[model samples]
Target: MKEIPEFQTERLFLRGITLEDTSSYQKHFVDYEVVRYLADHVPWPYPENGIEEFLKEYILPNQAMSLWMWGIFLKEKPTEVIGAIELCRKGKPENRGFWLGRKFWGKGLMTEAVAPITDYAFTKLGFEKLIFANAVGNIGSRRVKEKSGAKLIGTEPAKFVDPKFTEHELWELTKEDWSKP
Candidate 1:
């Protein structure tokens, strides 16, 4: 398995997700505001064992499968997780996803964290393209993808833990386009 490296952005630090992060993860993730638009796999009520099971059954076991997950922390408070991001090589339509605590929503923190990971996706992992999809109403997420230079390819029905099914705008970024000045 490829070693996951830590990343530092101007205002945030991105590191591997750890079991110790469970409490922090729960603090931010259990909020309906945060998980409403996320994938359907995210438990609606967010069971107590959610993060633990994710770390053990999914993340830890999938390192060799090219799945990378990160805990986003502010540089000033490096030990606290304010959000999370993941880049996976599993399925189609979308391979990248993230969510920030409601408190940090409009600060462009997610955008900052995205750049290095996107570069790593192409330059380190050798992925030819990266895909992202967000609920049609998730303007913040859409803006992140737009800022990252991902182009709108189409729209499709998507399932979310909160709303179940909704239309999502799909976006794509190619390594060639992302590498350009």
Candidate 2:
């Protein structure tokens, strides 16, 4: 298995997910506020073992292959995964997806977490461009992509845990446009 390297930002650390993170993952991720923004495929009444099942089935197996995921942690609370970010080689319309705990929202933490991952995608993974999407009214997520210089492409019908979100916005960022620091 290709080990996802551990890295850090000014206020956060990023590392691979583990079964041991199940408790913190469930605590932060199972809330309706968080899950509501996700693709409709995520069960609304999250299963009791959702975190464990996801780690084993979706995240762990693909972590070293077609997908890469990182458990986002605060510098102070290094052990708790407050959020997650992922990149996939194949675009199911978009190559990136992410979520931050509601308590930690509006602090630009997700934006901070996205930087190194985007760098890893273009530089390490050799992606020429990346596609991103979010439910149409999800301004927070859209802002992260916009702040990183991604252009708004268009919108398309999409399903989300929040049924009111009937469409999603698409954005694109090419290697030539990525401003790496």
Candidate 3:
């Protein structure tokens, strides 16, 4: 993977996640409201060392190899990790995944954060297109993709940390589509 570039949006900062971010990542992200929307593989009662283990085993090792991850923060509170966005070269039917702190919900933060990443994916990372997915009932996530010009290809059976979510929507955004006004 290319070096994970840091981004500064109008109100947020995006940087590669690191071990130093452990506490803040747990503080903001270890919540049911936030994790429920994620895939079923994530444990509900997230283990004490979950974040650290994840960074050490899954992220740090494969980073810059096949995966890229960025910790999301508000410029006003740059030290706190309020969310994360990830991109993987190999798709499990989708190339991206993300989650934001519940307190930051409905603020258009994710949409703002996604802009630069998507641009980098298409223009800088040589991705012809990006596939995104969200639980069928996740309106906020669904809207994020919709606003980004992703077209809904279809829905498929899936599972999330929250058992109620039984299906997921798959959306696609091509370089051609992203370049449009």
Candidate 4:
């Protein structure tokens, strides 16, 4: 079995998800405010069985692929998971997804965590571009993507269960855009 790599940023440690972090992660997932803007699949009142399903079926089997889901920890409290970030493979390019507890919002922590991972995707992983998207009214998330240099491409109307929603905006960034000197 392959071991997932751990990464360090200026203020956060991006480490692989362990069996230990299930509870902490569930705390954030259960918050309606947090999952509101996420993809249609991440159900609100996140299923009690969801975390285990994620670990055994989704995360463990996909360990070999470029896709990885990480638990984001504060540098001072390295073992405590405060949020999550994942680089998901979406056909030709990769997609970026993240969430921080409501308390950590507006602190530039997400931006700090995203930059190195953005660099890792284009530089180390040999990917040409990265993509991000959020529900149309989700300005905070859009700001994080923009801060990382992703351009607003267009808006698309889509459907999601769980919370039962629709409509979203799309954004994207190329490695070339991020690599400019």
The order by descending lDDT is 2, 3, 1, 4
* 1-181 per-residue lDDT for model 3 (tens digits): 2458999999999999999999999998899999999999999899999999999889988886798999999999899999999999899879999999998999999999998889888888899999999999999999988988899999999999999999999999998877322
How many times do residue backbones clash in model 4? 0
TM-score attained by model 4? 0.89
Q: In candidate 2, residue 147 scores what lDDT?
A: 88
Give per-residue CA lDDT, model 1, range 2-111, as digits (tens): 45789998999998888888889889888998888887877878888887888878887776366898889999999889888889896456898899999998988998
Name model 3 segments beyond 4 Å from true. 1-3, 179-181
lDDT of each: 0.84, 0.91, 0.91, 0.76
Clashing pairs in 3: none
Worst 10 residues of 1 by lDDT: 172-181
lDDT of candidate 2 over 126-178, digit per residue (tens) = 99999999999999999898888899999999999999999999999998777
Error of 1 at 77 (Å): 0.7
Write the residue-wise lDDT of candidate 4 on 1-181 in tens digits.
3466788877889888876888887776667777776777667567787987787787867864857777899999887788988888773222877889888899888888787777877887777877777777778888887777788888877654334547667777898677321
Where in model 1 is the C-alpha error above 4 Å? 179-181
TM-score of each: 0.93, 0.97, 0.96, 0.89
Instruction: Quote the positional error of residue 96 for candidate 4 in Å.
Output: 1.7
lDDT of 3: 0.91
